[model samples]
Target chain A: MLPMSDLGRALCIITGASRGFGRTIAKEFSRVVRPGSAFVLVARSGGDLRSLQAELTETEAGRAGLQIRCVEADLGLAEGLERVTKAAQEVATDLTEHVLLVNNAGSLGDISRFTKSFTDMTEVNSYLSVNVSSFLCLTAQILQAFPQRPGLRRTVINISSLCAVKPFSSWVLYCSGKAARDMVFRVLAAEEPDLRVLNYAPGPLDTDMQLEARSKSGDVQLRKSFSEMFSQGQLLSCEESCVKLMKLLMEDSFTSGAHVDFYDI
Target chain B: MLPMSDLGRALCIITGASRGFGRTIAKEFSRVVRPGSAFVLVARSGGDLRSLQAELTETEAGRAGLQIRCVEADLGLAEGLERVTKAAQEVATDLTEHVLLVNNAGSLGDISRFTKSFTDMTEVNSYLSVNVSSFLCLTAQILQAFPQRPGLRRTVINISSLCAVKPFSSWVLYCSGKAARDMVFRVLAAEEPDLRVLNYAPGPLDTDMQLEARSKSGDVQLRKSFSEMFSQGQLLSCEESCVKLMKLLMEDSFTSGAHVDFYDI
Candidate 1:
């Protein structure tokens, strides 16, 4: 296999593509990949997706023959997974030498409560259904829909976080979910050595999630820390973090199953 | 504070106590704690729990006034959790200067397929509902049921595995579940300094789980390695592993929320 410099005519499928780091991924990835590469943007907001799609279609790559499909669906349900994978399969064979599945959709869970306060089974299960279960299931479904074949490179990027490796007070659910997803992809990388799996931690970006963290975290000290980060201008923009992620993909030198952080790079 | 030698007049609650590692924990803990310590054994099999309770009444600890309560409950269901926590509260007041909660119930998800083959959302959700979601919810419920007081010392033991830190092929569900549970406890420890949290990895023990792993693991090499461990008499007995866990608690020297393995000690 030759060293690849770009995501060659690929079918790139991204969850949470309507906002935040995922939106940045859609914009950055579109510019670097080949002309025939297709994009499947998935999210819960259909209006946001259509607007993003419209914006992408207006780009130079859009006029140069790039295909973009907006999938409006909630990633927390089975029906949502089916809709996205079906769309991915539809555009999979069109000038596609590479397949990219970005498992980026996730939830903040209920950070308004401490770990000890999270005793409700239904609530906990509901959180895992989206953050943990759906993420793993969607990845597997997309991989099955687009199987390994000659001249095709399959890459999976699990949008991981520092929370996955370190424990944060009052953020137990989020930490647990991220850790589980990262391990799932790690096992996938181990099982399929040919696959490119990278657990990318996109720093503490100035996204809506940061807004939630700074305003409403259950732990006082943690909430203060996040607020201080925002006030001190220490948070990275979505585009800034996405650039580092794209660099990792372009170089393709990262060890499979490894967690790569934007700050680390 | 004095150095503790035993679980002094404590209320000990253990899940999956009908057999295997959980059963060993019940036996070893009953023998070592103070005379007034109460034991609440929880499992799916009411019959097994009754027999174990009857056998316990024959022991010196039982005869010397150690209270024993059997709760027939599945840790996977919400109702099951409610039953166990209620029973725990009942026995909690008597002989309960210290509180010990052992989270020992878990399931080995289907190892008949590789990670890529796990595409069904419902199947994955069911597995997680039992192993990951229920485990965290149960711990949180127990802690909430028995709020920390000045006179009571609280300790939680999460029965983790080597799989929690290391990924194994065809064992994505088990790995992800264990990894998630460990991070949950780690966060709990960070949030509550008064709580004693131990993520104890009881090596590759000789149990029913090993039997299933040796026979059904989808990865041929991993299955053969487990079989080889069994044939060479290298697997630790449940009693042996339980003894190490007891020592960890008695010595009380491990870092809070740290993952300690049988081999490491």
Candidate 2:
């Protein structure tokens, strides 16, 4: 089990760290993580990552010698996945006290109403590639790179969604991808008992993803639900969601192979 | 709901129809389907499909004027998907009474022990492409091409597996792909009430897939289970399983969007 003290020295790798929950989670880690710990942030936007790095450096945690490395790469592409894997390996040289891999990146991939036909094959391919394939590749690489040692804690947190278990009208790609993600982690959990794996559904968050869903002109009911959720203040802020997630991550009582929801936490 | 009599003139599209369950299912379909009904057989082995076509042509069903068209295409590739989609469209032009799409093609991928790392990205991609993406693409195309008409039945039969709901150690790709396939049909069912979608799980059939699983050197427990099942005559033959499936397909009582198992029937 990973104790709060061990988190300071842990090698944490987070994908989609440029913004949204990824960014919030990264920031949360910075606040709690020890100075010896290194953060490897992966995202497509290099500029945003750089800005984040600069921002973190100016913060109290950065002043205390918190290490941060940014890898500008899209998880949707093979080259991007390769880059993330390479960066993680390079960053985790001898500092493998506890390794935490956060698979937070996802793609909705041309959301359309269920009444309409699906998008082109390329768009569908991108959805699976980015959400499912990339997660598998990265998780596989991490598992291979970090063998379970006696005292070393390894935790894989897959940022899944309620859509994974529940079907939504215009969210087929997201739903299926997240479901696949959950199963992947479940399989890994069963195979590697000593390793900690969590499929965490963050629930409705005030993220760009929600904004994108609101922007869609498809399905009136779906749109109305999103709008209603937002207006009712039901969507949790990224910080709020991250706080609960971080709390759960730190707790040894949280069982591995569990599909944990934000509400449950 | 389609009566057994309507099966004769329905346009049937079967993927991976060259051999194994696909081939047997195609043959089973020939026996039941009426005269003037067209069969689009999709597989990588053109030679095998041609032989099946010739063999079927000699049968009473073929002599009765049941049309058979062999589309020798791999569902793992885009071109193959296009070819299959095009064939389905062409065949369904005049015969729009009923259209049946059987997504039977699947790949177990490069199977290995749970302890070992996964196969390369290429092999993994093939599994998702063939098992999930192609299924989605073809279903989408068929749904778009053949709109539901009053008194006409449009049925999509995804030959899923128990592995879809149950996770297997070495069968990660197959399990996840099948799960995704099931969810795809579920979403479709909810959206298109006029269309019938059946995620049929044919339990442990005596097909080449079983032979392949039995041939694996990894995971002693998995191997033992397969060997025991085979030796004990626990695995259903392709013919037996197909019969049950055919009955379910023809039955109006069979609920759409249900994850049906052979035993359940």
Candidate 3:
């Protein structure tokens, strides 16, 4: 692992940076990363990402030459992936000392039992494209763009979930997509020992995904379980989860290729 | 479990039935299934399935009123899925006593180390589409097409692999796709108890896939390992694997939702 000082010159590329854990993590990184650090924020909503850029730029670290670039593109499409890849590469050229990737964008798609065929082909395709294929493409692009730069700290943190390991009642697509994402990172970690790859499961955080799960109509049991979890204050706040994640990211004790949970930390 | 006599009137739908284990399984079914039974064969190559149909029709089972329908369409595309679904439904209309769906189609999708940027978006999409989404869609359609008819045994056998549980260096897409397939069947088994879902891992078979793996260019270690396995005569022949699979399919002792291996039986 590179020294913490090298992080000052790190080029961090984060997907789904407009909201939820993505936004929270961006804020945490902005506060913690030193001057000369650059961030390339990617998401579907240009307005949301622009607003985030404004917020980050107003911070003290931003004033200290922390660069912020927003690339508004849907990760579900090939064109969007190309755009993000170009943006990431351009930003990396400016800050080549260290590179970090956060594949955080994901979709729950239609969360329903197999009996309920609510999810169409397009939705399923988008889910796999965004969650698995796109992530793999971007990671590959980044790895290729920076080919063994001496003293450069290369790290990838895939935001996975409990669904990766456990099979849910009505979350077949989501569970599988996340599981694939984790496996991709696991394989990458094995193939590239110099690169740090972590499949980080943030646990059940209070986010839009929770709201979506609670509101699903097809699976009554699933909705009830989510509602109960909400009522019992079982869901961790995004702020708390981001703090723990940031801590984990900064620590050198965490082994590469490890699938870690926030609760475990 | 349904009685063996029910197999006489069973409507078995097999995907990737043109070659390899699928073709062997189709042959096995042709020999065992009594007259009045129907087989719906789906694959990209129409000619191959037609030849198989002709061969089966020459046998005693075919002469005894066994109906064979070949659906020449790719399981990776929506149009192909629609065509196959329609064909299966049409075949089911005539032989609706017992419906068995065999999701045997899959793609390795440019198997290479994660460090090697060999797999493109198209290949990745095809892998997920063919292995996971298509399988899910077909399963869902079959379940809907033949809803819980009393005395109508509904069984879904998903052809999975050991890669589903173990992560390999160059088999990221294949591993994840098979894992997703297994999880889909697992979920279906839970949601639809009336349906028997089996995630069957045939082990390493002496099929085209093994040959392809042995000849892979990106990973020497992976290729060498597969070659060693082949030289050691560890890979099971397609005929041998199909025999074991047929026995398991006919057995009443095997429970629904069981992920079975050929050696275990």
Candidate 4:
């Protein structure tokens, strides 16, 4: 794991951490953060988040009172984004400092059929709403609430996917949605140089979504062909990627919010 | 001008056509469309559009009774999208085959300031409403009402900007919004191969918005820089770009709505 030296005093808000990468990110931050730093956990599953929060409190990096605030709300809709933004702002106001916003929450819809017919309009619409629209809303809200403050060194890390750069037949919606998010950060970083914005593509890993996609019922032939991609047993654990990400986050020399791949490390 | 062959046998609906490229596009299509085709123009300026409809009828493209229907409504809001969609459906019903959806209406807010402190939140928010969110909503509604017929080809052409691929320092919000629209087309094309969903980045054109931006008062350095960019004659004319675009649309070889740039052709 990258040593968390500079993060001791940083304030972070991570979304979609109920399980998978979000959970790993929060726990890792808790372990590395300085004694006075704050970490906020956001997701839809309150119960799972509470358990994860408790687990975070036990880590050595968690000693900073590691103020953990769990706000359970769906990040898929406009209302959900507003609720989280309000809650996050309250935390920001209490600390009197801008935050390191981690736009990590997302959805991985069924990948079995690849392209569903118009009859699947509901699914396609939902995918666009949650995976793409919500990110834009959340970004706008955060930027509007937190204006630039001197010496704050605020940052926004938009978690994207390798699938965004390469076209995946089955993940048409998900891949393109992430690509949209990637562009959001890219444009924002160029507009505001002071604010560090990173569009990250965490390569394929052992996440719940991947596991589910691998086993989805569909054309046995198609599934068999796709499954071979993950069968190489090279999937990175969330912890490994989180550690690498933290390393990048702590480094003062890196460009702000470039679309980076974990495998590149 | 690319001849609008067989367009008279069908219907085409375009949003945001009161002025700018939208007005030019509607007129261009009206010229080449089959005398029997219908062209529905949607924008906020009803008075201007009504006048335009009459002028269009004087052309040969209109001699064959090419219907011109104008719907004046704000398309940035959800209600507006629904209203426009309903109007579009009414026009589509009159057609024998299907409808071609052109999401050409867009805006680029003033970019005279580099610092967010001097930025106008209302303007940025408005840009998102029109350029980003509403594109998806309109596309969804169109897909819902889209006529499904065997061996029939339907297309959704999204007019994007060169700002989508490359970032301009002061145009973050506009760039992000345009990029998001392109991403939607990317996903839509992949999911529905039958529907010709395309995202084309029409290069910088001499539009009223650009002129307004050039005349804005703000950070002297930034504003002067932008003014120079315009003064140097770096922008393309709307008619020139439209002619190029018409070539692509009529070529009929661009099967999927992949992101195409004018220079590429």
Candidate with the greatest DockQ versus the true structure? 1
**Local lDDT at B234 for model 3:** 92
For model 4, fnat equals 0.18
On residues A1-265, what C-alpha lDDT tens digit does candidate 1 reach at each position?
Answer: 4455777998999999999989999999998888788999999999989999989999988989788999999888999999999998887764589999998888898898999888888998888999988899899988888887888889999999999999999999999999999899889999999899999999999999999998989999999999999999999999999888988888888999999989899
Q: State the iRMSD of every prediction, in order shown.
A: 0.6, 2.1, 2.2, 5.5
Looking at candidate 3 chain B, the ten consecutive residues that score lowest on lDDT are: B112-121
State the local distance difference test value for candidate 2.
Answer: 0.81
Tens-place lDDT per residue, model 1, B67-161, is 99999987778999989888988887744788999999888899979998888888888888888888888888889998888888899999999
Off by over 4 Å in 2: A1-8, A93-95, A113-116, B1-8, B93-95, B113-116
Clashing pairs in 4: A8-A34, A31-A61, A35-A64, A197-A257, A198-A257, B8-B34, B8-B37, B197-B257, B198-B257
Question: How many clashes does the backbone of model 2 have?
Answer: 3
Docking class of 4: incorrect
> Candidate 3 chain A — worst ten consecutive residues by lDDT sum?
A112-121
What lDDT score goes with residue A139 in model 3?
A: 85
Candidate with better TM-score, 1 vs 4? 1
lDDT accuracy of residue A28 in candidate 1: 90
Q: Please state the Cα-based DockQ of model 3 relative to the true two-chain complex.
A: 0.52
For candidate 3, report its TM-score. Answer: 0.93
Segments of candidate 3 deviating more than 4 angstroms: A1-8, A93-95, A112-120, B2-8, B93-95, B112-119, B252-255
Candidate 4's residue-wise lDDT over B1-265, tens digit each? 2334445356788887878888888888776566467778888889988887888888887776777788887877677777777777676544446477889887665555442432233444556567665776677677777655774457788998776666666565566667667766776676676777777777767888767666763435545765887889877888888887777777756758577887887
Scored by lDDT, model 3 comes in at: 0.80
TM-score of chain A of each: 0.98, 0.94, 0.93, 0.89
lDDT digits (tens) for residues A147-240 of candidate 3: 7767777889899998787767778788878878887777777778888889899988899989999988356887898899999999899889
TM-score for all models, in order of appearance: 0.98, 0.94, 0.93, 0.81
DockQ-best of 1 and 4 = 1
Whole-model Cα lDDT of every candidate shown, in order: 0.90, 0.81, 0.80, 0.70
